[model samples]
Target: MAPWGSAGKTTPRFLGQFSHYLFRYATWLPVLIAFNSYVAQVTWIRGPSMYPFLNPQYNESLRKDLCLVSKWSPHRNLERGMIVVFRSPENPHVTVVKRIVALEGDVVRTKPPYPYEHAKVDVGHVWVEGDGDKTKDSNYYGPVSTGLITGRITHILTPLDRAGRVRWWEHAEREGVQKAQAS
Candidate 1:
């Protein structure tokens, strides 16, 4: 039999190796968690709510667009045409991604059944809409609290051919102009 503290023991060697890895992982786990929670993370985009900006074409395989979401941006810095990810006010468990159409105190046009053709965004609230005309958004659920916003999408990461920085502002501006002309 080997001595009590001898290096010839396989059990102690295995235990020591396991403990080293455990300690190393434990030390890094919190940092990883913090980064994922407050810095940035990858999010998968599904459905046609974002349409051409995201899931442009309908695929039977249900492949989704992958995006890098920045969690550190302040709400005050968010612009009218920026894309954002937020928790659905109607269902806390669901998350929705949409474009910011109006900020607090801004007047926005509304669709039917809202009692008013134009509505003013309330203080601390924002108006969000999907790129697709048929998408359900503020027009259906009304203005959402800015607090509901979780992050801003910074890049499209999927479909290697389509990977690039997200720049939809020009399109949004053109859409606004067209809407203005149509009205």
Candidate 2:
């Protein structure tokens, strides 16, 4: 009997397959994990919050927008009009995407559902809002700490017609918020 298996010269079939699986995964898993954690990630944007831009439609055909979220920006200062994905303050377990409407030290006249008529963004925090109304965002939760930000949406990669680079202040002219992102 061979030391590697049953009363035979060959290694067990299950053992060989298991080793191969481990070898394949062990060799690439760490690299994949690092790349996703520090570089960028692709995600499907769901819901109508950023309407006509991300997940445009709500009915059948239901084709959601696929986006590239750049993880590199969270360490730097974020500016107004940039779309961002962050941990929901109301529920840390969930993440939501919204645009920065007011930055720290900036004052904004907020709309209803947001208890106050005006809000001054405190240091280390920023005001965010969805392009679409009725979204559950800072307008509802108030300013969120910059520490909660996870990544910035840098591009839309799907639905061919809408695929392109997403500039920081591309939607600034759409209203509710109008400050252009500084270069």
Candidate 3:
């Protein structure tokens, strides 16, 4: 057999190894992509909006919760009561986490002490609020665009149950519209 024939057989083994590595990398590619551009895994709750449910400032003993926020679905099909992370409309560099109170084409009317002036949520936009009434949310800043939304909270890491996934109903107790009207 010619020397070239011997090299031909060796090429297959190299290619096989390369293919195996590619397969392994493919599995993590989505995660890597999310980590790199779409989702952020580590976040700090700066304010008390999350309140007793998340950050307990009064106790100073209760552990704070860190969560993963996925910006991938912000514009797709965001539903009410979902925990979302978005940029502050007044300031793009700042990020905030709040619950979706209303969506596009919805009328948002809140009472005094809060100034929205009976705003109408526009298309490609959403209304967000903190569970804590004291928080500065849509009541203060008004409706924000879907483009401003970065992601949804998928998991919470803190206290006893670390890596706990955040569910929809866990934050659905408050009625956004009703609360707005009541305010």
Where model 1 places Cα greater than 4 Å from the true spot, the runs are: 1-11, 113-115, 174-183
Using lDDT, give the best candidate's number.
2
Writing each residue's lDDT as its tens digit, candidate 2 over 81-181 gives 88999999999998899988887877778878889888878878889888886488877899999999989999999988878999776564434443323
lDDT of 1 at 77: 79
Q: Give each model's clash number.
A: 0, 0, 3
Better of 1 and 3 by TM-score: 1
Worst 10-residue stretch by lDDT in candidate 1? Answer: 174-183
Give the poorly placed runs of model 2, Cα more than 4 Å off. 1-10, 173-183
Please, what is the whole-model Cα lDDT of each candidate in the order they appear?
A: 0.78, 0.80, 0.71
Model 1 TM-score, all chains together: 0.81
lDDT of 3 by residue, 67-115 (tens): 7676565677787778888889888988888888887776766645565
lDDT, model 3: 0.71
Instruction: Estimate candidate 1's RMSD in Å.
Output: 5.8
Using TM-score, give the best candidate's number. Answer: 2
* C-alpha TM-score for every candidate: 0.81, 0.84, 0.69
